[model samples]
Target chain A: MNQEEIIAVQQYENALSRVDQSVDKITVLMSSAQSLAQQGTQIMNCFAQLKREQQAYEAQFKELKLKLQSDLIKFQNIVKGAEARLDRHLDYIDKWTNLLLTRDLGTMDSQELQYQRNIMDAIQMANDNFNKELDKLYSL
Target chain B: MGKNKQVQKSSLTDEDLYTMLSDNLVELNEIELFFNGFLQEANVIDESFGTVTNIFNGLSMGVLASMNKSDNEKINRAKAKIALGTFVVGQVAKGVGSFYSYVKTLDRANDILVLKKEKAATWLDSLHRNYDRVLRSEISSRKILTHLASLGYQIDELISNREVYDVKKNLMQMALEQYRKARFNVFSMEFFIAECKAWLKNKHDSNMQQPILQDVNNSIIQEVLFQGDDYEEVIAEFFLGSNEISGSILFVLNDEQLLSHYLSTRKDPLIISDGVENKHINKRVLAIFKDNPALEMSNEFYEIRKEIDEDGEKSRKIFWRLIVTGSLLSTLVSFFNLYLFCRLVMAIDDNTAILSVLAIAALLAFGGLYAKFEEIYKELKNKISKNRENYERYYRYEFALKGGFANRRKKVEEVVGKSFFDRVGKAISSLFDVGDSDDHSFYYEKLIEREYWNPFFVTVSIMLILAIILTKLNLFFVGSLVVLLFAYLKMRMRKKYFYILTFIVVLCVVFLFLYMKGVI
Candidate 1:
């Protein structure tokens, strides 16, 4: 082939090579974009799942709080029951002291005196039980 | 004469050919001009790539969902890309950093050659970008070789286009040869351009990012369960995109040998990030920063500072442990001496004077405890002074980073777009002027508060003992000690105002006199 024909062929080859390179770069870029988009969508789903888990945790916390509140109320009821028992013991003491001071043997017969003594013993036992409960409350 | 007189005849084809040649030459010139601009922009891109990588690495892992089947790949890719970008940009930024670092130390860079040297560095970097772009491209090797071949021999010989390109070896040789020629201190514009082109061509071939096919096809997927690394804030923002991700970063171990980072989605997080083992924070930051010496040094400074801090803590603990031991010993000795004094009193011997000596020893022990607190305060003040002293060093590195050294240099130029530190200095000066409440004393106040509890209790215990001794000494001594103890209490009322002045005046006079005279 003549030199002119060779030169013509070489120029054509150079242009063809550049086109190939550009097309290759563009193709890679396009595919990368598509893959990236797909990945982004997947990430969104993961975030959605986390949001659900967070909501579940909040619900669990609320339930836990209620359980603790009920336990606290049970302690309060024990204290209230102890207070009522103490009030009855005080009432008996006040009434019996007045009877003893008045020297009313007729009003307080043997059976009545026995009944007052029994009530005093019961009050003493209740006071000891309340003290034990108080110890437990303080420890808690 | 008859041949010369004959006019040279031209075909229409010859005219067309001439026009095309003229057009091609003009196009070539335009291409060169366009290339210069693109190369500069690529430098900016290279810098951006680095900074973006740091941002991604620093991306909080809170953003990335817990590693599940989905969203893991996306996060992983982002992480890997950032790491890789930092590595490459680190390489580019170092050239600029070194030049600036050199500039600072060149107290006598007044010569024309020195300024010219900077110009040469600029030119080299400008061309380096072109080389990097070429390295990362997919242009045919033949095209490059063909252009290079034209630079060497006759046009006809190079244009023949029958040659197979031996690009790898040829590039290395060409670059080395240009460098050798450049050793003559030839700073000519043409020579500089040639050298840059040679460096670029040597570094990257016409074809870029080839698949890097290996003979051993070992592309097997192994599930890496990265536990204990946990989800970090930096990676929280990273999430999986599909089940597959791919990228790379550079990692180094033992302060040398930059490694090619390989990322894959099949593995767990830090499945790959665990490149550096047992990194101090500074070293870890440095690892991210790579060849940026300013950043490396900056990180290194912090590491050293932390080590110093740990050492200081260990020392303080040892000091306190000794004090507690001493306090207990003094208490025991005081009891033993008091027992001996009681026995001597019953016997009515002159040996009872030993109690006075024991009393003096107890007072000295109290003085020792007081000194320990003072030492702690003094050390704290020293810390303030030293850190303040270090302000210059930190600022220099800051300035170096903020100046025109590394990634920050380009960022400041882009974001702030002017002399950045000028405004920073102004703000700092204004802060100092406005904050006249003396923040320095705030730290001292905290020290006093911490020291107050121990020293106060010790003083009270000592004064009570002193009062007992005084009572035994016919009441006069007891009254004197009572007076002294009350005055000490009154002094503590204005403790913050008196920390420095009171310590210097009262402590020196009181502690030294008491210590030297054996009444402390």
Candidate 2:
């Protein structure tokens, strides 16, 4: 071909190539959009599963807290019952000692009453410790 | 000049070729400008691809499911394209529809641009909406042809109608896979937050009745699990109520406080607790503590502490064993010693083998009885009070020697330059003053007093007794006399030269005696 014809053919080819590349760019963008949407969906699902795991842990924590509170209450009640029985026995002893004063009667000593009081104190201390520990766990 | 120009023009085409060339060049320039704009757009998308892909993968399980869906779509599309290409190639080879196939290629190339125009616009709008700042700003200077003009002559040669059509088809097939891989980015914080929000929405939808509870749960879960720096809270919360919690907190909370708390407050003994949990905690604590030299020394400190504890327990047990059995056994052995000596004297006239057997049997019996008694005592002690601190004296002495835990910890911190063995050696050297000249002189003096004079006197007394006993029997033990003399010489001598001199004299005397008896 002549120089002018060659130049004209070259210009047309350049134009066509530019158009082809433009189409390729558009195609890339199209595919990119589809993938982005898919990725968004996938990421959302993974996050949901992780959230579910966290929820289960929270539920478990609540259940454990309730159980600890119940245990503390049960222990406190046991301590209170023992303390009441000791008080009732002390009352009975005080009432009967006066009736038997004329005869040689076996009597509960004041030391025995002190020992019983100490035992009650020890029980109360244990209950207090349990409550303190329960408080710390509840705060957690 | 006009006639010559007319002749030159007559040789060219009747078409306005120069004008047409100029117009086509202008079109080319515009197209180049548009192409560069698209490239810049692609570059921005490529950069965002990583961030988007990471956010998607991290936040969504749906990416994998979507990957499967897209992969199937790609496979089916590729198969259809391959079938169509095969049919076109077959028709062209048979010369049945060459023009038709050529037209079809051009149509297919055009379809990629025309068909996806609306889709591309929508996607571009979406890009702008989602990532406006991420998309690079357009270059204002209109330099159109520079980028594509530099793609080399072969690229220019290949940009013909047929080749362009072929290239477009290949580009489409390749672009899908690239896009799929570069689509999601779990690392993008914005996208990650959006994904978490989406998850919250989905979870709330499922439990619509308990939406408030779901929100609370999600918040608590996020706070507990995603503790960026304050990991101690996570561990503390994990072990709050359940003693039987699985896994370990060591990875999250590597603090010494956590380790010490775990160690001290363990419900079961270390021996009975789960081995895996213990191992994990142990490895993590050691690893963390190792970063500080002072803390690393605790490994040896704890070891020595444990040894000291075991020693105290052992000494106490032995003390009890001695009180219970050793005193009675010592008395029995003393009587037995006297009886055995008598038997030895008497058995000289009888079978010496029987004497040897009797001695071995007596020794074995004592050893066996002591061992059995110790075992019984240990079992009884264990049954009575397993956690008992019955031996005060032993513990007091041990603590006095080892110092308190605080003292040991201080010592570990202080002695950071030396190893455990080196520290122990230094301690022993200090006690003995082994490096001091005065200490050596004192040791030498003590050695001479105890080893030389004391043993010499004892040996002389034994020799006298033997001499008396052998004279009564009318039998002299020449070898025994020689051996006793040699022992006395060795004990008396302090210098090496004196020892050598005594050894020579002893050897000569022994040789002379042996020659006289014909026993050499």
Model 1 achieves a DockQ score of 0.00
Residue-by-residue lDDT tens digits, candidate 2, B1-520: 3422342333222123222222221112222233333334323332233343444333233322334444345443443443344344333322322222222223322322332232223223322332321111001000111111111222222223333323322222121111111111111212323322323332101111111111221222233223243434544444333232211232112323223323322232121123323453443222322333223333443444344455546545554645445424432453355355546664433334434433433443444334444554566456333322222222222222221111110111121113446545544443332331323221112111111112334345534643453344211222233344445445556679667866666675566546545585
Output candidate 2 Cα RMSD.
42.7
| Residue runs of model 2 more than 4 Å from their true location after superposition | A1-140, B1-261, B264-305, B309-520
| lDDT of model number 2 | 0.33
TM-score of structure candidate 1? 0.21
Model 2, position B257, has a per-residue lDDT of 25
Q: Candidate 1, residue B6: CA error in Å?
A: 52
How do the residues B1-520 of candidate 1 rate in per-residue lDDT, one tens digit apiece? 2211221111112223223222221112222233333334334433343343333333323123222422445444554444454345444443433332222212111222232233334345433432332222212222221232223222222123212111212231222222211111111212334533433443111121111101000110011111123322222222221121111111111111111111111132122222233331223232232443433443454454455455555544545554565455544555465546546654423343445444544554444444444455467546644643354344333323222122110111121112347434433433232211323322112111111123334445545644554345422332343345435545555767546654555555566446545574
Which candidate number has the best lDDT?
1
Candidate 1 has an lDDT of 0.34
TM-score of each: 0.21, 0.17
